[model samples]
Target: MIAGEFYKWTDKKGTVHFTDNYLSIPHEYRHQIKIQKMEETSEKKMEGIAAELLIKKSVNEERKAISDGEKAFNEKCTKCHSLSGKNQDDSATQLVGLLYSDKFKESTLPVSEDSVKRIIKEGGGEDMPSFPEMTDKELNELMRYLIPYLKKK
Candidate 1:
């Protein structure tokens, strides 16, 4: 039926009726009738729900990855690279400043993801112990934690 062309009317005995034919509705009650649009189809509604679920799942996964990265950094690097700048012993470096320093940029060590992965696995120097035992996945997580600090000024 064409939208806005349908009619609803109540009879004298209080029974209600709906029809697409304008003639079926009595003249007195015709002014009271109003057409209503159809609601969305189930398929359309389900598609919207599915899209929303996918977006939520992606966001949740990102949050989990970040949390895991922070945990890995704390477990692996905090011993040799102090998170706080103060009170670092001779054996350890203050990591926060080092990440943004020109010296760090000039070093032979590469800072890109794959290069960082190699360095983490092989160790940067004699002063830094090799973490050959760390899996590629764990190294990735640690790198995620450190990459923000390594950004150029």
Candidate 2:
């Protein structure tokens, strides 16, 4: 019997791919297109779903990394640095007070903001510990916080 209202074909290799116009092919070739198109459609759908899942996972990972950085700064830098409008009761604040003294003002050392950041990164005297782990941005922020108190009269 004819395959259907629309005939199709196959090859000796057993591939069943189809075209709507298959009338010129031999009878033996008709079986090749007989199986179904739904299987291929399902495979493509699965591939699309996998790609979407991977994209979502990458975005989530980036957000998580930023969250972890913020948390770490709060736990570490916060122990010493105070936010704006806050009291200066912390050890780091007290240290900054000394830097603002007339003696510091009189010192020949450079008074620029980058210089202040270097002091924080490398430590001034034996009383201060090295902050090798702090990023350049964090060091700059810490220096900015202290600069107000250390301004020249």
Candidate 3:
């Protein structure tokens, strides 16, 4: 891909919206990006506010999902891919945290029990390993545990 300038506009709420295609932005914000280069401080302030708001939103939504994912990870994945002091860098344990991120919520990255199970039992990536012995039922249980986080976004 070639590197190029991206047009970004700050909303009234200070959210920094970005787009490569001009049609992605609303008319209200279209002028903001065009005018923003005139002042840099305001841009920084807007980005900071946007970041703060993003963090706050993420922290607020996982009250129950986080608890459930942790419980499931502790109960199941912990059996082998331990999250103990000795296995601090464990792969399975580490994956639990991102099992249901909004980043993977779409069809492009569907986070379901079956999806996780397939990866677990048929692991193939550079850092992945197969848990071929695991049954479909077990995978479903794991997905059940992670359902909350999957639904978060």
The candidate that wins on TM-score is 1
Q: Which of the predicted structures, 1 or 3, would earn the higher lDDT when compared with the native?
A: 1
Tens digits of per-residue lDDT for model 3 on 1-153?
123344667888886665445765788777666533324536676576457647656665545545554675676455555423243234434443454543345447455566766777888456566768766655555565565543442
How do all the candidates rank in terms of lDDT, highest first? Answer: 1, 3, 2
lDDT of 1 by residue, 40-66 (tens): 335574455456547756886777777
Order of the predicted models by TM-score, top scorer first:
1, 2, 3
Candidate 2 lDDT by residue in tens digits, 32-52: 555334344566754564565
> Lowest summed-lDDT stretch of 10 residues in model 3?
83-92
Clash pairs, model 1 backbone: none
Q: Which residue runs of candidate 3 sit more than 4 Å off their true CA positions?
A: 1-72, 75-112
Q: Is candidate 2 or 3 superior in TM-score? A: 2
Off by over 4 Å in 2: 1-100
Q: Candidate 3, 139: how far from true, in Å?
A: 1.4
Cα-based TM-score, every candidate: 0.57, 0.35, 0.33
Steric clash count of candidate 1:
0
